[model samples]
Each structure stands twice: as structure tokens, then as C-alpha cells.
Target: MAFFGIFALIPLVGVVYFSMVKWNGMGTPQWVGFDNWSASLTDKTTLNAIKLSLIVMVVTWGVQTPISLLLGVFMAGRQRYRAVLSVLYFLPLLFSSAAIGIIFKSMVDPNFGLFSHIPVRWLQQSYLSPTLALPTVMFVITWAFVPFHSLLYQAGVRQIPQTMYEAAMIDGASPWKQFWSITIPQLKYTIVTSSTLQLVGALTYFDLFYVMTQGGPGDATRILPLHMYITGFKSFDYGRSAVISVILAVVGLTLSLTLNKLSGTGKMESQQEGI
Candidate 1:
């Protein structure tokens, strides 16, 4: 507890300290009052970056969760080589973001990549134009994270007592009916947990976008973390970077609390605890 307390406190202290100063990562930080926060709010680039980040989060929620849940359900009942298949699906998540990004970039190459064989000019066609870049990034992230989400839902599905399925079966419940009545309710916690995890990841994602688009095609794919990185490292605007960091932290915390409140897990856990 003591170690965790100290470690957690360090970030809070740094946020407060840097948020009030103008530091160029050199000699010393100079107190700049609330200039950082004020400037960050008004800076067009930062504002645009925040917008892009929100877009990625929304797209991930829409595209990734449903597919993962479906795959989880499909894999849960099958007796065939489930472990091997799960591992194969999860391979993408095991690679470092840099490595994955480089591979994807190469694979999407127009001149000498498999994507070009589609009879369409995918890579050079600006399929990831300003309006499409963030969505494309969201697709890539979904592909990367979906397997882990499937594992999560699979675990939840596996935990539902076989007796429940037997009972459902004896009652003449069809597979779809059993799924809607039993599987979903039992896996509620897993759904909530995985959605929350994806939300947090999308809210702060940087690597895939940074490597693939570099938030390119004109700031279309720029997310908050990447914006903060560019501000501090690329532009030496530490104060503004610190402000963005604080905002990112606040957004993450707020969404986490919101997700927890909606999870229904708290009520269930409390009831179980009371018994």
C-alpha cells in the first residue's frame, strides 16, 4: 500500500508542478501561472487533436466491442482446438506497437504490398483522407485489441455453470434463446469490463496512429497522447503538453467512473459481499 501510494502520488505532483510552469526540458522550469492551460484550450492544433481523439474512441466503441463479443460466444461452446485458435487470434496483441505499426505500414504499401493486389489503389487513394484517417486507425486498433476482448468474454462464458445450460436445454430453449436469456446476463460483467478497458485505451492511444499516419493527411488521426508528445518533444512546448496530459488524465478518470457506475457490477458485488 505504501509503495502504491507513493507511486500514484508522484504523477499527481508532477501534473500540478509542470502544469504551472514553462519548462523546455533543459535547466529549470519557470512559473507561468495558468498560461499553459489557457493556451492549450485556445490552441487550434490541440483542439483539433482532442477532436480526433474523440473520433477514435467513438469508432472503437462502435466497431470493436460487438465483433469481439460475437467471436467470444462462438469460441465458448466449441470443443475443437479452442486454445490453439485463441492463441493464434491473440498474436497481434503480443507485439509491440512499434513493431505492429511498421509491419502494417509495409503491408499497406502501394507499390509492393499485398494490399495493392486488391485491384484497387488502397494505399495511394487517400482512403485515409482527413475524414477517414482516424477511422482507419480505429480499425487497426480494433483488430489489435479484439482478440483480448474475446478471451475476456470467453472466460466469462466458461464460468456460467454447465447446469444452467442443461436447465435451459431441458426447457426447450434454442441456442439463440439460451444466449439472450442466459449467456448475456451471465457475461454482463465481462462486457462492462472489456468496454471500459477499450474506452480507456482509445482515449489515450498514440502508437499505431503515430507510426502509421503520424496523425497525417492533416491532423486527421491525431489523438491527445500523440498531441502531448508532439508538443513536448517535437515542439518543446512543455507547459502546453503538461496541460494536455492533465486533461487526458481527467477524461480517463471521468469515463472510468462513468463506466463503473453503468457496469451494474458494483451492485452485484455488494450483494454478494453482504451475504
Candidate 2:
């Protein structure tokens, strides 16, 4: 509790206060009311950042969810061959995200990347260009994050009582039917938990964009987090950056709270804690 207050709670309070002030990276913060917030709201770049952030959030969740869930369910099987395959699939999880971004950035470079060496004409096109940068970023995010989410789903699938599958089979349920009725239903809570984390985490995904595209090819990949970073660090408008941060925090908290409300998981967690 003490740590939470000193770190998370206190910093959050400071951020809120800072959002209303006028300050560069240095010098004292001068309280300027909601001027910073107003400026952030009116900025064209900020709007683009917000739009890109939402698009990234939606596309990431959409692409990652089905693939992760399916891979997880498949890996949960007790097949001998899957042991090797599962390890291969999880290789991405072992690398740091920054390293993954760096490696891929090199791999996709137009002149020197792996794709440039390949004979394929389409694959060699400039991937980080304005026309293709957003898609490229989305693809990289999916590649990097799907394994972790699948691991969550795998654990959830394994926890399902084997007897349920057995009973379904005895009732003449086909494999697909068993999966639909048994597997999906059993993994509901896990889905909620995974989704809340994925969506919220997407809002704060800065490092990969920092190292990969650098919100580059002319702001094609500059989501809100990157925009905030550029504002704070590059532009040195700490106050306006704090406004963006507050906006991100508000959106993330609203998403989390809404998911918790819809899933009823918060009540369950509270009840379990009492026991």
C-alpha cells in the first residue's frame, strides 16, 4: 500500500497537476489552467495520433484474439509432436520487444533487409513508407504479442475438466461441436482477462514504435504514446505531453473498468479475497 501510494498514486496525481501547467522539460511548471489540455485537443498531430491509436487497438485485438485462442487450444493437446512445435511458436516470446523491433527493422530495410535480398518483387517494396507503414506496424505487433496471449489461452484450455470433453464425446458431439460448446464456454473468463490486458497494453505500446518505425515515414505510425513521447522529449512541451498521458490513462482505465463490469470478474475477485 505504501509503495503504491508513493509510486503509482503519487505520480498519477502529479501527472494530473502537471497536465494543467506550462513547462518545458526544465524550469518550474507554471499553472496555466487547462491550456495544455486545450492545446493537445486542438492539435492536428494529436488527433492523428489518437486516430492511429484506436485503429491499432482495434486491429491488434481483432487479429491477435482468434489466432492466439486457436493456437492455445491446439497446444493444450497432449500430442508428442506438439512439444517441439509449441517451443518453436514461443521463440518470439523469449526476445525483448526492443530487440525484436531492431531485428525486424533491419530485416525490412529496403536496401539492406532480408526481403531486399529475396527475389520476390512484392516483398521488396518499401515497407516503412507512408502507404505501407501502418500495416507493417500492425503485422509486427501481432507477430510479437500473439505468442504471449496464446500461452494464456493454453493454460485456460488445460484447466478445463477432461471429463467435460469425455462426456461431450459420449453424447456424440463432433470435434468442432465439442470445441464450440465445451472449449469456448470454459475459456470465457480467460478471454475477458486477456482482452482487457491486450487492449489496455496496446495504448501504451511505445518502445516498439520507438525502435522500429520511430513513428516514421512521416507520422504514419505515430500513435498517441509516440506522439506523447515526441511532445515531451523531442518538443520539450512537458505540460502538453502530460495532457496526452492523462488522456491515455483515462482511456485505459475506462476500458479496464468497463471490461471488469461486463465480465463481473471484479466482484468475483472481491468475493474470493474475502474467503
Identify the candidate with maximal TM-score: 2
Prediction 2 TM-score vs. true: 0.87
* Candidate 2 residue 167 C-alpha distance from true site, Å: 1.4
Instruction: Give the clashing residue pairs of candidate 1, or none.
Output: none
For residues 1-275, write the lDDT of model 2, one tens digit per residue. 89877888877888866754433422326767777777889999999999999999899999999999999999998998887889999999888878888888888999999998899888889988998988887898889988888998999999999999999989999999999999999999999888887888889788788888889878899999999899889988888887787788789878888888999877322100000
lDDT of 1 by residue, 1-275 (tens): 99999999999899876744433432227777777777889989999988877877787877888898888987786667876787688788778777777786777565666656677544454445677666666777877778878888888888999999999999999999998999898988988887788777776677787888887877777778888888888988777787787787778878777888987566322100000
Query: Which predicted model would earn the best lDDT?
Result: 2
- Taking all chains together, each candidate's TM-score versus the true structure is 0.83, 0.87
